[model samples]
Target: MQLIIFKDYNALSQQAANEIISLVKHKPDAVLCLPSGSTPLLTCQLLVQKAKAENVDFSSCTFIGLDEWVGIPPDNEGSCAFFFRNEVFKHLHFSASHIHLFNALSENLAQECAAMDSVIFENGGIDLMLVGVGMNGHIGFNEPGISFDLYSHIAPLDETTTAVGQKYFKEATELSQGITLGLKHLLESKKVLLLANGNKKAAIIQKALEGEITNALPASIIRQHSNSIVMIDEEAAVMLT
Candidate 1:
């Protein structure tokens, strides 16, 4: 595990983008795990701008969504798929066929999980997984108390997550469950890039990176991975020594 505290969000996003751009440059077909939410929005934008400026090729890179709210339509504004489509995919020069995302509306949820798991398995596993730590230390929807041994599975959303996530919806939305690539999948990645911004994330960021490894704080488990990097703005890094 490695830690990098930047002066502000832009700097953090730039650094993160550079790292990802480097990966795609070296391996255009690299499989990437991406996240939604405001924290990573700027980073994805920067990645697009940089890739365009450098004429970096992303036509062969594969993108995999990390999680999605269950029961939501893929086209719904609140769905992770919609968020990524508008935020990341629309900005990339990648092939549409290479974009893999969890099916939150799958009638047979178990089959959905199995299918996504198989996709990851067939892709030779994720080469780079970009993540964002939630205010409660949750990673993807693997909330506190989630088993680290699990693979792609359904997760019940934490209260804190539901409340914090409400802002994404156009109106009132109740998200009770989520479909996510389990912590095991994230930990198994060849490289992990986790980002956090804002002073509101300061305390949890400190705990996740500097505190003990435990499932109770899902992001803390990143400490167990051999190739994980954490990037945070100074505000988010305020609690760190």
Candidate 2:
């Protein structure tokens, strides 16, 4: 894993964006696996700016959402659907047609999951997947105890995950399950970019980078990824030496 520490969250994100832009320049139609939550917001902004200022084309690009909270209607303001439409796609002005998201509400959710995995495989797999390390080191809500080799599945959110996600939800009880592309899918990407920022993440970031490769800290599994890049802000990198 490659680590890059920056002065602040925004700087860390910009550096990550530049790395992605470098890849995009080489392959404009790259399939980018995007994540949600606070850490990636600035990175997305920088990415869209790169597309605009440099006239980088996103028309041929495709986006796959990392995960979605179960049971929320697509129209709900608090949904992951809402975050993608507002924070990433709308700002970047990418065609809604090329964006793919897993809807937990589909009548045949089973079929949808199977189709998504098939489509990704047919498309030469994902080029890069942007990820945010949860405070507990959970990656894509895989939580603790789950094997990283498991593919796509519906994950029952742990109490900590549900509570942390409540920052976006109205009620903690309303947040239970999440439809996440499994750790296997994340590792399948040609490259992985994991971002962490702020004082809140300092402990986990340090542990993830400096600690052992064990299931107790799921993000540490990225240590095994040949192309994984762990980007962090100053505060988050504090204990990493």
Instruction: Report the C-alpha lDDT of model 1 over 1-241, residue by residue, as the tens digit.
Output: 8888899999999998999899999998999899998988898999999998998898898888999999999898888899898888877857988888888878988898898899899999999999999888999999999999999899999999999999989998989999999998987999999999999999999898888889889999888889999998889988898
| TM-score of each model, in listed order | 0.97, 0.94
TM-score, candidate 1, is 0.97
Number of backbone collisions per candidate: 0, 0
The positional error of residue 191 in candidate 2, measured at the CA in angstroms, is: 1.1
Tell me which residue pairs clash in candidate 1: none
Worst 10 residues of 2 by lDDT: 166-175
| Model 2 residue 155 CA deviation in Å | 0.3
